[model samples]
Target: MMRFVQGKTALLVSAIMTAMLLTACDGDDGQMGSKGDSGVDGASGNNGLSALVSVTPLAVGHAQCAFGGQQIDTGLDTNSNGVLEMSEVDSNQTQTICNVTQNTLAVDLVGRYQSGVYGLSAAEIVDYHPLSQSAFVVNAQSGKVDVLDLSTLTQTAVQDEAGYSLNNIAKKTELNISVDTGLTLLGAVNSVSVSGNLLAAAVERGDALGNATQGNGIVAFYRLSESALPVYLSFVEVGALPDNVTFSPDGSVLLVAGEGEPNSAYDVDPEGSVALIAIEGGVPATTATVIDFKDFNIGGTRNSELNPLIKINGPGASVAQDLEPEYISVSADSQFAYVSLQENNAIAVIDIATATVKRIIALGLKDFGLDANKIDASDKDDAINLQAYEGVYGMYQPDTIASYRWNNTDFIVTANEGDARDYDGFSEEARAEDLNLDPNHPQFAAAQDKTQLGRLKVTTSMGDENNDGLMDKIVAYGGRSFSIWTAEGQQVFDSGSDFERITAALLAMNFNNNNDENKGDSRSDDKGPEPEALAIGQIGSHTYAFIGLERTGGFMIYDITNPFAVSFVDYVRNRNFDADFAIDTDTGEVEGDASLAGDLGPEGMKFIASQYSPTGLPLLLIGNEVSGTTVVYQLRLQ
Candidate 1:
């Protein structure tokens, strides 16, 4: 709620044709501007009212604001190093930048988490390599992988991660090539991965996400050699939905994690798999061996509804669901793969070399599948989907599952849902209907009769009493409530009187944010991802969860120095909403909220912590999805 008017140094300049032709506005102070020009839906709202300042101004000192809101917001310290203040003055006439010194307020359009290298195009980049500026980002709906120049906005290259190439590469001739005629000699690929100088991705015929069908998921390769543009090569077809591709720390081998289904909605389960493409100095075959998602965590419970329904679709079709393989994080040594099975609320530990699912950890156990189920499903305008309605259709509650490492061996956070507050929700009676029992869709219209889960039944610390830092170890905070856990999964924290975790799940935060606030940790060669977990929780001295209340509640800063008793700092902004945070270790400068970039549903993100940059600052890559549009945010901490 920090509000401030930028020094529109550019608005002081001349006019743009787009803004001027809006039938000129009278100099009335209270005028709301012509009743939203009625020409095109969203066309030509850009013409400026011709302010005298320069338009492309740089961020300067922060300014304090007395009021703020949609039009003129208020509340918030404008001088925080990472904060950007915001305020909209008269249509087409407002400050574009507000850099205050108070340490709190922030600007809406400010490039806090600017678009770095976008991964899915639909989502921002997840993990990025600072050394090569190469990253892993997906344009899921497009079934495309984009390699970007984080420094530059333009895309460096796009690879097809689903084309056929990596299957059985060890014995294929197209894969075994001389040291000279590199893999890049192949056609535009499907998927790609990179490490240090070695880069690789897979290829699959037809966009895998576009269909509920299956194809030969290929693996391709490319290396940035010492020569100018040294190498661009092909790996080979690996497997179906070879979802996540990764590399060994030494850049010796390439690993691809399969999501199993090309499209979950359509239910094409082509053996959830993985593939290990040999590095002939980083060359892959025209076809690679197809392993499976099972090699990870038994590939989660198979989608029952998708079995008979999954199939192939050419183009213009609904992108299937459940096929998402949320993430694949590797240990510092690349010995283990921490794979997340978001759909089933499970995290599997896999042995990289053996391609084995070593351990499958059940997360959020105290909560039932119907606990988070939605009951409101009225097709009418503003109609709500029924909750138990999902159960009646053979569905359980779904979790977002985008958790990642915050700072320790067992510490990582995943989102339970991408958008908890997007809908109005269904009634208890309307939700109880089981989807599985009604697979025939007989009473699809008679939804009012089914029973619902009754407000996320399950109470605080209901599960994980032992607190082992594992999912099952944590206790429930009570009644479909959102709670925080220790690395060992102990229910160490829950918002007191907080509405619930179902709606407002704590989002991205560095456990170190307030921890290192007073004693900043100097980034060292041995330093790991910051451990202090950062989250979007209740603000003020309140000891309760916000759980996404309709009203704004400000962000809470926690100094988790003592895991047993984490301390709360102060409230910054309440409702830029589902806020995400990232900080530059070297500069001590921070950036957050970049939420508006991904529509309102900004959820699931990854930050790249690779080798030092030539300029010395390590890089951070981020990605998120909202309202169908996937946006990327890439920014150097400094």
Candidate 2:
């Protein structure tokens, strides 16, 4: 059995940070800028790979991320409006836009799941496959990797999310049925990567159930076959709690972000660092290298307080206090690695070659949306002032990083939801969760701050108003659904338009009500926004993003090509039929929800150009976070 992390929410933290590692061509291709004072110079980073800028400009092939999926557990709403206007498949919305017709894809987290309709959960499916033929989905509640093969006509699982809560997976093709050691760690699977057939997993230390921690603090490996159990490899001890795992572009080196032994508690080493696991001659379990972030920043006290802010429960009452590495994603070329320091509210960048600290980029700023010179409330409050913030985690928690790559450059985007901190879900004795978990408990009134999270508006682009590279205007939105921002964190588009429609929907839906800022005796003054489901991909150069409102149905689209004037274009409702499998289980026929013509249930999206039309068309990969499984749809000009 697996044990829960010490704190309320222990996650992999990866904030946004972009850097490129290049080399001098034999000749002077002055085309590239002067190599400035080269820092972290070494082959530690997987060279040959270029940094990605945006997720536009598709690559050839019938499949450009063929489909998409997302698990809705966190904040999907923006404006804190209390309605589920985002879609039809939303939890509270009885009407659905899923199975309107035949041969369609729509999944409801609960509706489609209870009957074993679709094999998925509310906290599942974290990534897509590099081969584009499979989805490396994870059942976070359980260490299971649902390797769903999208190649054939039916939904046959190659690997179910059973054995472990498979956080990450890597395929090393070099092992032709060799290096077979089937040893596996329970919660250690934080991240995974493939380096020339060597599958590396960054395992978290500490026995979750034990009062005393017990993790080796290393980057471990497992050999594999297209089938059969995995082969055991070796481990390289690095920092405290190593949470994120990724291979450099060339697959030569492995970049790992350590949470410092206590992935969610205090760091045992006090040295926040990343480890480099080298793969020499394609052999498994080679030597490992370490890069210390504290070592570099220690040059002066100006940076002391910046050491990742870890969560603590008084001195040592066993209440669980630890720092954690939420997520880590490397450049396509493997030159730079981005790690999310969730507890610390920071993003750490690693230069593979030199195995040195590049820079630590902070996430969120309280005053992101405030006009630089405006005399606004957010500007005046010392509490909300945001200056490329690293967040105050006494309670408020941030998480998740969705990266978008354009051209050769890449960018890491972060999602800051509430939870992960102790908000009592809005209660006085919330730490006494048993009381707070009670929806009808009288003490529930004391628990008022449900909207613990908000968009980190970080920019001023007309399109990116209050730009944090995300649509902050949605803060006025009810139901925390998906919001699209420009590559530069500008306001791109929100699944729901104005607060009226959005809140009306959120309130009607009755989802995450305690999270409403409108409640009395709250932490932050009422901003009045409803919450929704989590969003997956808004990559490709498309018109908008399709959103999934838990019950209102699973489909909401945003016109993003034009950041300014970005509006709600489509929405789907509760006409769902495709929740469990690709095949229509209801009538044994294809179930297509045409209700999505105008406004429909569009939970999440993967951009794709329509075959018939040459212009950019988007494919809406829809799924219900609470009731059903998932569905796929195609979108066009209204």
Candidate 3:
């Protein structure tokens, strides 16, 4: 109930009562009348029928805000004008509302789209065009992006007596990345991003023989239409293996992460880099500013500045080549970009205005010895056994990352989905039991048994610090959790074991299940749940972080309005646990009822605010790689 602050009626009544007492006392000549028993306080007025709120976007350089925040105006509709006017606003309530926490938000699966192709990357990365009311999804299996029309997508449109059709939604068109570009080779679209009426796609280059090539990639541009496929504009050549791409918030720049992954034979290695393309007049510049990491190479100027904890383990590869930039996130002001170096377990800060590397912050290891950082370290155990091994640690090898502002300060969020350098020519991975542990180390006997810590995968390069052949400390691949970090890469909060604990309690039967197959406890030895995809959104002053669990087939939401005081909000999974969706032993293929399997292996996620949503409600779009499906969920606030 909204109370009004007014003094007209109450103050007038008190004034008249005082006048009557003064008149009565005047007749007694300098004698004051006794206060007749303090009169009872009048009852408060009823609340107004409705309280209205209006939000206006603030511009840059505002003295009272950072990165141009929202200006909120709230008032009671006294005149019933159906809009909050300046005169109706209460003077006492005029303020800039910031970070009001709420826990009433939930998500409901409203629509889904299936691409028929299973076990292939039919849908990997997804981006939406608000004006077009469509989603541009990266279909790596078909070498194109499948466009799905969401203008008519509704709960009723997708529902029927026999349930919804596998192909309920309509595929508007296929956006082939190689459409207008003249140069042709084995190409694959890795990522896509949309801003306003423009769309950008990152395409990786391959050798003519269809093998992975160590050559420069390309970032293609297009013009989004209201009811048709994107019109190709132009393409700019970037670094090797452009894995991820995104546009700055202001649409002034486009950034691409050149992963520069080496071939399986380890024959050629390219230097990882970032490309900054200036977007002018709705088209990319003729060339891009390529920012390479050569300064951090061995014996280079910045070589001595390297952090000791940053991993540089690639065989015969310089620091430039070993530091692979997997993902990119730009600050709200578009002044800087944070590039996640997954293999190196670090993040590179790039000054956008200067197009130069400002610094590289190394993400430290997570000590599992702490009680809060426990893990279920065995798939062969056949049960959820969460324990803390004293000598074990986890690398915060983040795959996808994002940036947000809280209280006008920037913070970064990462999905600590660890990766290993396992290839045909070089492999640094081994099961815990396969390696010989130091006899004097704690939990040494437990590491030797398959049902305990033996099944966990660990990197072989770091444990033997003394080069004594016997491992001293076990360093695992991924952190198995998400973390909030300062702009300088200092970890502020880590959801240690929350993912495992929540999944174990809610999905005990399907604990640690793999995405392709429904075998419980299979991924426990590997990265549990593998939080890869991430997106941040704001609803009614509260900010939320949505993390996608790649293996377990769902997403988790957390209240991140206060990064230091984060809390779990909701967990939703659409996969059918009862369905027998397992890989075939003979063909090594996932064969089961595709319709019942639901969405699996969420590779990419995008959040749409209410204003840009088709239904005028917040929505989340996810692209599931293994199941080859794209699903949509509407945010429902109670």
Ranking by TM-score: 3, 2, 1
Model 2's lDDT to the true fold?
0.35
lDDT of 3 by residue, 1-638 (tens): 11112554355346445533443231122333468555555555443345666676542212343222346565667777789899876656455432222237857677788887777788898999999999989997466888998887653423322222345567998877776776677377899999889998888887554556577898888899786668988889999999999999999999999999888977677889999999987878989999999999878999988897798988999999999999999999999899999998999999999999999999988998887888989998888888888999999999999999988888999999999999887888999887778998897888888888888999987788688899888889889899999998789999898788778766884867898777887898898889999999998878889999999979888888899988767677887777776644234376667567778889999998888888778999999888888988888676
Candidate with the larger TM-score of 2 and 3? 3
Q: Compare the candidates by lDDT and give the number of the best one.
A: 3
Candidate 2's residue-wise lDDT over 401-472, tens digit each? 444454444654333332332221221112221121234323233223222222221111112233345322
Model 2 residue 524 CA deviation in Å: 12
Task: Report the Cα RMSD per candidate.
Answer: 21.9, 23.6, 13.9
Model 2 weakest lDDT span, ten residues long: 58-67
What is each predicted model's overall lDDT from 0 to 1? 0.33, 0.35, 0.82
Candidate 3 wrongly placed segments (more than 4 Å): 1-103, 155-167, 208-210, 583-589
594: Cα error in model 1, Å = 15
| Clash pairs, model 3 backbone | none
Task: Name the 10 consecutive residues with the lowest summed lDDT in model 1.
Answer: 524-533
Please report, as a residue range, the 10-residue window in candidate 3 with the lowest summed lDDT. 59-68
